[model samples]
Target: MVKINKMLKSLHISNYALIDTVDITFDNGFNIITGETGAGKSIMLGALSLILGERADIKAVRDSGKKSIIEATFEIDDYPTLKEYCLANDIEWDDTMCILRREVAPAGRSRAFINDSPVTLDLLSHVAMQLVDIHSQHQNQLLTSPEFQLRVIDSMAGNDTLLSDYRKRYAAFRSAVKRLHEAKRKIEQNRSDEDFTRFQLEQLDAMNLVADEQEQLEHEREILSNMTDIKSTINGALDALLNGNSNALSLLSEAGDYCEALGRILENADSLAERLQSARIEIQDIADTLSAFDSDLNADPAELDAIEERLNDIYALQHKHHVSTVGQLIELRESFRARLDELENSSFTIEELEKEARRAKSLAKELAAQLSKRRAEEAARFEADLRERAMPLGMKNLQIKVELTPTELSSTGADSIRFLFAFNKNQPLMPVGGTASGGEISRLMLSIKAIIADKMQLPSIIFDEVDTGVSGDVANRMGAMMQSIAANIQVMAITHLPQVAAKGNAHFKVYKQDDEHSTHTRIRRLSTDERIDELAVMLSGSTVDNAARANAKSLLNIK
Candidate 1:
């Protein structure tokens, strides 16, 4: 596959550390950055780190009253995964370029943005991981990490899909096991509470609770308690309306007769008579209704006692269940019955879950075995490749082996991987960290990176003086390896070695400038002549002579 070139186009930093403001555009290939001790090369890397979602510190601010800003722009024309990542995360997407920015306020507050949309630090870190890989001197300690060792091998093995599949199977197995255990626990607990649950269900079933039954029973009880008053009132109303001598019905009838006589001589009198008739009819209906009510009002003491007892039962259940209505009590009763039913059938559920767990475990184990097989196959190739790459970098008698030991299935797989090394002939192999020197480790890291560069899918890698303990020919060889790797990806190196610095397609010099009150750090791209002078200075240390310039020209092949 033709790898898409995704490189950091430019980085802008302001009010950060010793840099008031610095903007540097990078090249697409090997880019070199060189500076004297304490000239702020690392500070520039620190600013870039902020863009990569490193933790922000208020102390990095050049001025306590001003906010520090770090922004990085990348060329990402054909990187579809990154575009998909932005869309997945709801970040604004730009087809050809991506901008990542970080701001740290004077109060130590931090914010990150992608394509100008706000994002969390974690998301920014994930996106930036695809854009750049920054290897510093401290990262050398990763050589001792088993996880890192496994990742290195996996990257070379091209096991992205297989690893993803194995992890999914492993996760399913873990979930199934958890569910099976929970089901067993639930069965045990329900067995302990079986009698109590059965008793509760039986009590609710005997009551046979109904919806709205409580309100209906309470209303019946109220009417029964006031039965005498209600009956007397109804009788009085019926008499006043119908049976009394001066009842409303009789007076309304007499008024209707007068209105009918007046209608013969007056126009509206007939309408008035009709209205009086309507009023009499209405009074008669009211008397009939009152009579029925009086007849129905029987003082049934037995029914009253029955209603009271039912209401007390309802209230007792409501209190016991912590409910306020008959509906809620009914719902609680059904829930208890459901729990009992589930308990009765719990053994079946447990059996099913156990079967599911066993299936999942079997599938995971199968995939783990396949993963182990592939890793074993790749381990031999990786061992040979590492030995070949490192042997050229001063490990003349290098003997490297990748140890893959069987382990219980984990998220990564069922293998524990370690890199064993013997830097001399007839030397017993030990773990790389115990056997290799700092310089040897550096070279091994570089060689590993070179082997996996095409697979990492990263746009750029910045080496922060990873060539720490090497000198002369080894440094030159490391630079050559970086240059070779850059043929397929962007490479940036910070070095004090002219041998390494001479190998870059573009060079930048970082230096300190002293003003009146404070010192400032500045970096600028170097011209061809300026690069030569800088190389001469790096070679001679504070003195540039004819021979150093000639040697610098010789290194640059400027004969």
Candidate 2:
């Protein structure tokens, strides 16, 4: 694990196309350059990639050259594994053990070195990767990717171990809840129709019967069916008591007269006659009740037949209702009737659903609060570090912020962290791509580096015309910011801003010129005058106007 504390200090490029030979040292932090359009501005950073193990390009070598060399020094520690890998790959690992270098040839071959020792491109890439990161434009579009989203959530959650647990449980709980809801929905979907339910319930309940009511009603019906025969028999008995010679009442009357005759002969006979009279009165009262019942009874065959038909109808109903007897029908009616009675008071299903929703919300709130607290700490630290780094870039107005609000627990958790910036004093800090403009993005990018450099721990962070959308004072500030950041980290930037160009500790100029066979690309280190002329040309245009050259000279002289 080689840690790059200092940015790439210098580079030596040889026989690399237009970059025939150039030796330049870099600032500890940000270095910016400005040149005319089509200048071999990209040669500087490209050389770094080659050293880090990108594929060799045969055409990149100069026309007459056999080999290309890109050498650099880094302020890093000697990592044992990287050292061994260098030796095995035939690359160099020097004593500083911090430097990584690469060499290439027209033969499509490449080699790498760390601290002057030999290592393969794979080894260099691995060791170099930890020390540098290149977050170019293409991958930024994938910010919404789930993998990235997960990483952001994990970082805020501060619990990789717990995140796994949450994921497993969330899947299970969501599945169970979904299944439960679907099952209830299906139950309701196929539920019996309301009209059918009402008809069945009414039919069953109309029985108005108890478990034993059916049996009692049946017995009473049987007695009523015999009304005609029973009434006739009772009538004959009553007539015998009232008028026939063999009638019980008449026989009792005769016996009473004989008793009265005997009473005259015997002293106890009067008492016997009185007793007989009392007994006759009691029998007469009972006979009167029976006569009334007989009078009320219907003797018509039609009435009896009608009653029998009604009995048959009830039996048929019992059979249709799947009841073994009237008792069973009554039982079914009573049970179902009670349920229907309660149904009248049953409430809506939404009431229960609302209660469940409140419960889920409460749980989500609790978890969200916990997540927010942890993120708050991280945010404060992140912003403070960014502010601390921006001071050196003359951006005392810089404010890096992480805004977190309480949001519903979606798949992304309850937090969203967007990088916000304010490059100007008292200006509202906007999101990275807001109306802040390109100059602002450049400064913001450096501020982010200042905040995240420790975590990144990479050897180089390249800025390619990142200040395109800004000029003048703002561009100058961007240039200064880039230079300051490169002090501690390698910042290789291609630029059109003259302020940024002048800030470079070393300068390379790229231009195309024709040879016999083909127009070849040419890049060379700037001599003192050549550097002045280049800066002058950028300030004054290609003709090197006197006033523009004078201003360029003045810019170069600024402390």
Candidate 3:
């Protein structure tokens, strides 16, 4: 026996629709829910859908005074990745249990939670998708959806790895193509504005701006502006030192001579004479240096004008570039040079990217071809299996075909798939969507879903009246198929067929009751005897007779 590792443990709904509170526990087997029409089976489904992050209307709230809460618990020890997802998303979860809860308040607001940690609806839906697959009768319309059909084919072909690789290659090709187009656009835009670029470059070149040149020019300008005062001060200092007769140097020389004469008679007179001589020598050097500066201090107005012009040019360049200093302008110049270089070599870059894109496209095409080949091979097996499965379900003359026509490469690959069908013996094959009756389509969809259930490792599948137009052996076979699927995962069917209901390992009945104030929907797990009674009632329309009881007993195999 296959070890059943995953299943929905229980669902608790409160104040949703006509259900004040309906709590049901489920086991890891084929659990069947049966009720008469308008008995609120669909309401229960709507509640489950809310926990799955489906939107709920305010009318779904049974009471305007309280909030509606729907919660589901799942045994997910078998789904390790789901646990990893919780950890990655920082959600609190356990190895043995995963809880999903949704609440709608009377104020028309809603919230979702995973393990009591608040979460967004999208995340809840993502996690819920991995937990349960609700296959309703409405999904039969997916037969006409090409994307759905391709996915069906791909699932059977086991194309996950190949399709992933092909998509990666396709993404790379697209990226390269995008780069090539951008490069071409840049080249065209730059060429259109090339004249402005060249003009700016020429202006910067003519200015001949240098690093630190502005500071140097400013110093020169200041010196020229003060040349006359500087020269006058230097000349006056030179005249006082040497040109005048009573200058400090002359006085010091006379004093030095007197000290030398007195040195012969005094003790410290020789030391005093040496200091006076040294002072006189330093004074003479200053006088000579000042005279040289006076000669060189000519206020050339033309040189000053040249300096001002150079400084102004530097300032204008700074203003144009919106920069603060010459260094920033220099950096901007280099950037312009780089853009020009790229524009000049745009052809080379475009060629390289195009080559890369083409190589990636070729690789993607090759992988797509391999995917197509695998799908073609699997289509044959798919056709054979559908025929075998459908024939047993009263589609004995069902000519099922999977046609693959070549098409442009896509995320799924380069194939257009159409499921063809012909129910009559002498009829021509046509599209399954147009040719098959509603009953036949329902059966066909079931066969496909069953095959998929075996291929995939899902936790649970809930079929909501998918067996709408089948009876007798066909319903029995449908139930058997559900049972077979349940051997690997949990299967739940919200059904009304007695034949289908009789095959459940566990059965629940949903019914309505009229209390004093309002009508309420309730669900209860049926006992074996109760199941017999319910099945008999279904077989004989509430008037259970001896023959209906016998037939129900025969269906349930009661001794």
Q: Which candidate ranks first by TM-score, i.e. highest? A: 1
Worst 10 residues of 1 by lDDT: 1-10
Evaluate model 2: give its lDDT. 0.63
Residue-level lDDT of model 1, residues 444-506, one tens digit each, is: 888988998888675589988978777888889899999888888888999988999999999
Q: Quote model 1's TM-score.
A: 0.84
For candidate 2, write residues 279-374 as lDDT tens digits.
888778878988888777755666657756655756777778777776676666665555454344333443455456556555555555666676
Q: What TM-score, computed on C-alpha atoms, does each candidate reach?
A: 0.84, 0.45, 0.80
Q: What lDDT does the true structure give each of the candidates? A: 0.89, 0.63, 0.87
Which pairs of residues collide in candidate 3?
Answer: none
**What would the per-residue lDDT of candidate 3 be over residues 318-358, giving only the tens digit for each residue?**
98889989888888877677778888888888889889889
Alpha carbon deviation, residue 329, candidate 2 (Å) = 75
Error of 1 at 528 (Å): 2.1
TM-score of 3: 0.80
Candidate 1, 449: how far from true, in Å? 1.5
Q: Give the C-alpha lDDT of model 1.
A: 0.89
